[model samples]
Target: MVANGHHWDPKYPEYEGKFTGKFLHSHDFKGVTNEWKGKDILVIGAGNSACDVAVESARVANSVKLSMRSPQWFFPKFLFGMPSDVFAAKTPNWIPSIIKQFALS
Candidate 1:
């Protein structure tokens, strides 16, 4: 079966033969924390899904290893009564960060 992300990381192939633990998709995690829930999890990737999974998993898991090829950012799902994903992008760039940050606080 095809993987979740659009592009498969080539290095991940090595983990198929190396990693000896459960491999789960964040999309399927419906709050059913698994047996490995209490242990540290190495979440591979920095995309939205990876970040989301890491945050959720961190609640139950001791720690999370957010492996990222490069940096990533995630605005909140809601801000000012709108989805931050769209709002952050639409907000005028001229607005100072402190003002927005204060409003959010």
Candidate 2:
């Protein structure tokens, strides 16, 4: 099994220097603050961290935009009243991927 920790360095986009607006990595994000209250924000990924940041920023930012290269499957925190992770953990591995996808849909 592959095991990776969460302390990896943030990867910057190639256009980092081209754009003049404020840019920051999700890894460096602390939380929403008054400084973000009226600024336009652009989040660059579709992962959990990006989603969290976008949601939080929307609460205070004048506008928040999420940009991703492609679409992704988004699962809610809860499924059938149980935590989604717990539900996935309890599912038998014998189930086929197609069936799982259908069920989730």
Worst 10 residues of 1 by lDDT: 1-10
RMSD of 1: 5.2
Tell me how candidate 2 scores on lDDT: 0.76
Residue 94, model 2: lDDT of 98
* Candidate 2: residue pairs that collide: none
Clashing pairs in 1: none
lDDT of 1 by residue, 1-105 (tens): 112364433232244356566776654555535665688788777766676777777787877787766776656678878987777788788999998776655
Shift in Å, residue 104, candidate 1: 7.1
Cα RMSD for candidate 2? 6.0
Error of 1 at 84 (Å): 2.4
On a 0 to 1 TM-score scale, where does candidate 2 land against the true structure?
0.65
Q: Residue by residue across 1-105, what tens digits does model 2's lDDT show?
A: 011124286676565346766767777888898989999887888877888888889998999887787888777777778988898888799999898777666
